[model samples]
Target: MAKAIMVQGTMSNAGKSLIVAGLCRIFKQDGYRVAPFKAQNMALNSFITKEGLEMGRAQVVQAEAAGIEPSVLMNPVLLKPTNDTRSQVIINGEVSGNMSAKEYYLKKRDIVPEIQKAYQKLDSLYDIIVIEGAGSPAEINLKENDIVNMHMAKLAKAPVLLAGDIDRGGVFASLAGTMMLFDDSERAMVKGILINKFRGDKTILQPGLDMLEELIHVPAIGVIPYLSVDIDDEDSLTERFEKKGAVGMIDIAVIRLPRISNFTDFNVLEYMPGVTLRYVKTVEELRQPDLIILPGTKNTMEDLLWIRQNGLEASILKHAALGTPIFGVCGGYQMLGTELSDPYGVEAGGTISGMGLLPAKTIFEKEKTRTRVKGRFHSQITGLLSELSGIELEGYEIHMGQTRPIDHQIACLAVLDEISGQQSEEYAGMCDHHIYGSYIHGIFDGEGAAQALVSALLKAKGLDCEEISSVNMRDYKEQQYDLLAKGIRENIDMDQVYQILEKGV
Candidate 1:
């Protein structure tokens, strides 16, 4: 079994994921075979592994930092919210079924064995496992059935580092209150405390930190500075949605669906210079931009209905009429078609009228399409997007249905296939004039595709389209990981962390 340490937060969005990712990178740099583990994750941001298995994106990012291939064992149970009350439960990377909150809570105990099995599998393969806990461990009402906090700590025999968000204010009370909720044995499992997202001088915070440590009887090992790193976040509490910046020359707006999933697909475009990518939720927030995007959603039919009910559909259609570039991915792709049929009650057992932006129709199927694909843009393109022709792209598909074009005039955007050399002439997406729709997520992660698209947008705006150097997404991510590791190493006490891991509770 591997030596392990777990990061539990006093509340959600307390920087547990980032801390664990930083630790993974630091351990990997020190020549240790480290991996990330989360017993259960309730999030909409997910990824499809090379093996076509589903896992949380946070674990995938942590795995990248560790310089290891992501495995389903790293995230055993994934809960993707379908609505306010129900979620689609995935165990061991496969769909178990959809369950309501009450039903899932009652049955959660039965999944413990499965979680333990996955944990042991990773433990046998790696030298260290940095575990991440979901939400807070101090939810006293839910702690009895908890498999992700103190209970998980006891199961893995892993020491815990409780982190509190200082930026949210009352960091001392948050940490102390969390400690008071836990029993003596449970409190003993927490080896140290960390203050995350600190912005001001540490010298001024020393008094509060000292009082917090004395009250909780746990040493405050670190005060991590608030970092501005571009990494995939776990859930709706992500800061990316609220962050607004000056609109660059090339402005891109993404429709923020209520059930948005795989929103990280646009992160690369956000990193590009001279581009301002913003997420718009309401029709009023929609602005005239060079390009507009519809991101993936957990429930396509429902979210599409939301667009219609909220008048966003009218706003999008109006933009499309003005020849604004419109693109969609996954569920968004389904919503852009002419019609959508949900036969299996996947999202409601009825047909819905799509935005009719593209000449296509979608049918919901039981099995999900999950695979990695490599390909090049179609030889032909429409309107201002002709520059995208011949650009190579690599991405993954994770969707619930198949979309097909209704007419031969609608051109396919790309010719894609499995990375294993299997050829697929299947029309992956449809493009008609300035309107495009595709089921492929992360298509813009590659430099060729992203750069070409940006150049076309620049040309459409009648701006000088200078040839910019292409940036490799993978290399950029590695640099960010290094930055995160450096931040953690300078602030956190690594010696104390190692000591806690060595001498477990």
Candidate 2:
């Protein structure tokens, strides 16, 4: 191994992902080429790599911070849950198949060699590799076959920094408890402990940090404060839509349906100047928004039913009646049609009624259409976008349904010409329209599109708002990463960390 460090959380969601990202950025700033690795990641939120491989968007964000193109090697095993008991196992960007919790645990050991291979490949190219472990490393039952936490750390011969979430309270208990559960060899791999998400005074945490270090006989590496970094969330829990506080400017509401997928699409818009993204839990909340966005779902039928049960379906009709700009992507797009027919039962059994926003229908197929597409703009939505009426925009498609027009309704308003960059109007709602729907995700990645859309929503609300510069995700990620890297260097005992990475644990 070149040089490495593993960030193992005391529990899941203890800011491990952010730590890895910060380390990756810091390493890069120190003139060391760094790569982020996670042996396994389970999340519905994902990203399409430059090579057109689908991986967890968390690692992708880290990769962007490191100024590197994302690849499946960054995350060797991805478990995207289709339901509670079952998940789609993506090994190296290709779906191996669906497996139950019991089934996957039994078979995970077989894929250990593949994980090692990916790690070695990354280690070879980078001067340092920062590893992010999944969940808690102290799960005694899972420790036997654990390929993601301590087991992988041992395999990689990397030093580990155990992190605990201070914001959740029990910072001491979580760290001490996790340490107590580990065996001697696993315990030896741990270099020190770090407290994450500390709010208010650092002086207040100093006494707690001193006690933790004394008890564990490990150095307290750093105390990280709560930071509002503008980055895409890894899973449903970190979702901004689940956030409280009503939207400040535009009454932007998202239908908080079950099985929501790829919500990172709205992160940029949510962070834009004078835009408030709200998650609508009830029909009343749904009806009040200036714009309604139906997010992508893993199980379309299940979420569609959730929409109806929550009374969002009727609220959507009411909003549309008032000329609310409704937008949907992929599964959301499928829901906007007249009906969702899964005759072969790919998603669920039989058919379900859609919101009927657009005059269209969707048919679920077994063969999933997964590819990077460049969409050509067709319809005119704003004056700023008029010049872009025929511009090709890059995005991806990861859906199992095909939509067709009903009663002269268009399938996709934007037709992309990949070769010439020429765009023509094919359907009506793929890119931008008052009541729009499209199979393409991340349509806002287009230049000026995010600000334009935000500007449009603000206009609809009749509020004065300034359009900030287009959110260059790649650039913004790098900048934030640089800041984080600086933080880690100044706070962490880098000399000690480097020594551990050099020598096997």
Backbone clashes for every candidate come to: 0, 5
Deviation in angstroms for 216 in model 2? Answer: 2.2
**C-alpha RMSD values across all candidates:** 1.2, 2.9
Segments in model 2 whose C-alpha atoms lie over 4 Å from true places:
379-392, 407-411, 419-433, 461-469
TM-score (all chains, Cα) for each model: 0.98, 0.92
Error of 1 at 221 (Å): 0.6
Span of 10 residues, lowest total lDDT, candidate 1:
418-427
389-417 per-residue lDDT for model 1 (tens digits): 87777888887889988897878888785
- Name model 1 segments beyond 4 Å from true: 419-423
Question: Where does candidate 1 clash, by residue pair?
Answer: none
Q: How good is model 2 by TM-score?
A: 0.92
Index of the highest-lDDT prediction: 1
